[model samples]
Target: MINQSELENSKEVGIITDISDKELHLALGLSDPTCNNEISQQDQNESTHDTSNSTAPSEPQLFFQAVGLVRGQYLPSTEKLGSGILLLDDGVIAPTNLLASAVYTVKKHPNLLESPQVWIVYPRVQVKNPPFLNFAIRGARLPLEGEDAEVINQSVDDFSIRGIVTYTNRKAGNFVIKVYRNFMPWKEQEGTKYKPHIFTITGVLPSEGLPCGQFWDLKVKRVADQLVLEDATFITQVFEPKKPKKGRSKRQGQKRKAKRNQSNPQ
Candidate 1:
């Protein structure tokens, strides 16, 4: 047998004894082994918090963008009652029901040969009963049975029909007037082109388009034996709220990934 000191030296040299975790904890005066678990739990909670507060992507908005004169026209069933045809800017005649409203600004006033004429046609709207065209003009206050003969010519020839209220018979489809100047008031803002005769006729639909079979017969309401202008419609092509776009953005994709990772922690 070896000597005691030799045995002790041999054990110390041959096998290095390390302190156990239990011994280390006891030395450090720690009773709870769950501290590490608590730290891990805190880290997880922080990750979840970051993910919860993250913002997703936003959607785009909808608005109306106007398309030009190629989209204009008179309403349906109002033909054969005019001295001259109301042609488009391209010299093409506007079809019936081209517009969803009756309000037209006279860009080019009519000559004696090419009179300003249109047929009053109404648009179809959603209602229990069909709607009627109630015709009336404004600002005209036509001379009171020969108050002054010159008053008629001046009123008719003026480049501005703003607030001029006149009347037409609701008996026929031919609504006629004559403009003598090619007034483009819209151009007035760009430069002094020509003074425009803007006619603000009422009884037009505020929006566009009409469904099938939604029109009523003409309603005759005369303002001092003058024909009323009603139910005429003009349509325009505009970009409104269309379908939403198809893909997600980079940040949005990252947000989705974060959510997935949160749901299933590694």
Candidate 2:
């Protein structure tokens, strides 16, 4: 299961963009086509049984055939990320076996003109894992001058970046590229552009040395005009909840090895 503890530990935040009520209904298992028929049958059968056999409605139970969707910007709080108002089929505490975060599943529409949508947000506990991380660069200019094409945040795993980027004068193949743990590098990857003061980095967790609860600083050599310079600082943190690891079976491992061999083509 997705680890909520780590998410809670990390001091990161996000805002809810959009929400889809229809998708949420499906997620909550409230949109069953046979729901009405099943309820009718159950009621009829209960009527035939002894009146005493019927479950007493001592406590009132609320039933919702439909739920409303509210979309807005949920600003970040000290403890957790922001969230949208969504009425779920049932009131369920997140961090249960089923849910990875407070919000069930988020559909991202990055470039959409409309406000992004988020399904639900509980009043008490904010989501530990947000859909993405907001990364902003400070005190830096675009298109790093000289041999320093860009400062790439290399990640060995999907959750957080943990790798090395060296500045060398080899004269060939010295360009640094940014990439996620298991994802391919962006085709148009370039150095940090100063246009957008804030940027987003999507990852699940931090590197081994980095603390889970706090942000860590990375001091890199600032480059300008083909000259080595003093240390430039960059910060990194886990944006969202890291996906749970899946154990690989023997057959799957064998298949991976075979695929690797085919690609190498000895």
Candidate 3:
């Protein structure tokens, strides 16, 4: 299960380009053509007999993109260097599971021009466990720099994101990747420079997090499926973007990993 308590301390990935929705959907596995229509006749009868059936369909296991992509590598978080990997925080009440800092590349589509199409420029926290997390969405633009992403003080209108289920290897040990919906232009936006600013997201704004964003009592729903993750609530910070520090000289960028390690800890 994707840990729900370590969002503030998880490893992150950043892509320096724009992505498309269709590609995202295909990547997230939402476009899988296979469907299990075969069902026992007796079970089907029972399903019809009971109208108030509250039992949820079986939840599929999900694989994170980073884990699937990175081999013989490690992920770091603010809390501990590659520790409690499975104990991820759900970005609520406290930011214990999300990325502490990151420099991702994102952008909006030209069609959605009037609506501020913002490329999410922050760390992309790869969800290691899907069963542990529920209700995922992608493509909802987090307001651009100089544009307030605040849900308070009437900052901006309510927003919706696009999500694509890329990989669903729910075979007991398989996981999936829900890509950023409509994420093609991201490639084009590479080197499309802009000022980097801080993005502060209260745990509450995220529905999956405990004490999630209460700004508008935002109701979260899966874009493609109704297979909801555990529906609990808590409060925590998800992503807090800050202005990117000025570039350091090549020497600084090329600092030895050993020196950086000294500052990190044993």
Candidate number achieving the greatest TM-score relative to the actual structure: 3
Least well predicted 10-residue stretch by lDDT in candidate 1: 59-68
Candidate 1 residues 207-262, lDDT tens each? 23221111112222222213234433322221121222234667789999999999
Candidate 1: Cα lDDT at 225? 16
Worst 10 residues of 2 by lDDT: 59-68
**Model 2 / residue 205 / CA error / Å:** 14
Model 1 TM-score?
Answer: 0.15
Model 3 per-residue lDDT tens digits across residues 1-266: 32322222222211112333333234334332122334577876786676442222121222111111100111224565312122112222111121222111112232432322222121223234433222111223444578754532132222222222211112222222232321122123434433211111212222232221111211232212112231212222222222223445566666776688889997
RMSD of each: 36.9, 23.4, 21.6
lDDT of each: 0.26, 0.25, 0.26
Which of the two candidates, 2 or 3, achieves a greater TM-score against the reference?
3
TM-score ranking of the models:
3, 1, 2
**RMSD (CA, angstroms), candidate 1:** 36.9
Better model by lDDT, 2 or 3? 3
Q: Give the range of the ten consecutive residues with the poorest summed lDDT in model 3.
A: 64-73
